[model samples]
Target: MLNSIGIPGLIIILVIILIIFGPSKLPKLGRSIGESLKNFKDSTKDVIIDEEDEKKEQKQ
Candidate 1:
């Protein structure tokens, strides 16, 4: 779904966010989003490793 949104679309969306949230709050919002994504990535990596370990145990 995001793939369909090209550079122009992204720029428009960003502009909208800027208008809605204003410049002062944008930094805080961006930081929170970054942290959320980082946590999500770490959790997904752990899940993948656990699945691989389970598969290895089954094979043995």
Candidate 2:
């Protein structure tokens, strides 16, 4: 859905977001997004590792 937005459309969207969030808030917003993504990755990694260990234990 988002890919349907061409280059110009993407640029327009970015501009709008910048206008709404402003430069000062942009850094904080980006940091929050990054941290959220990192947390999600770490949690998912833990779940995957736990599942693997469980499977290994079952085989043994």
TM-score of each: 0.86, 0.84
lDDT of 2 by residue, 1-60 (tens): 978889999999889999999999999999999999999999999999999999999999
The Cα local distance difference test for each model comes to 1.00, 0.97
lDDT of 2: 0.97
TM-score of 1: 0.86
Query: How good is model 2 by TM-score?
Result: 0.84
Q: Evaluated with TM-score, which candidate comes out highest?
A: 1
Stretches of candidate 1 off by over 4 Å are none
lDDT of 1: 1.00
Q: For model 2, which pairs clash?
A: none
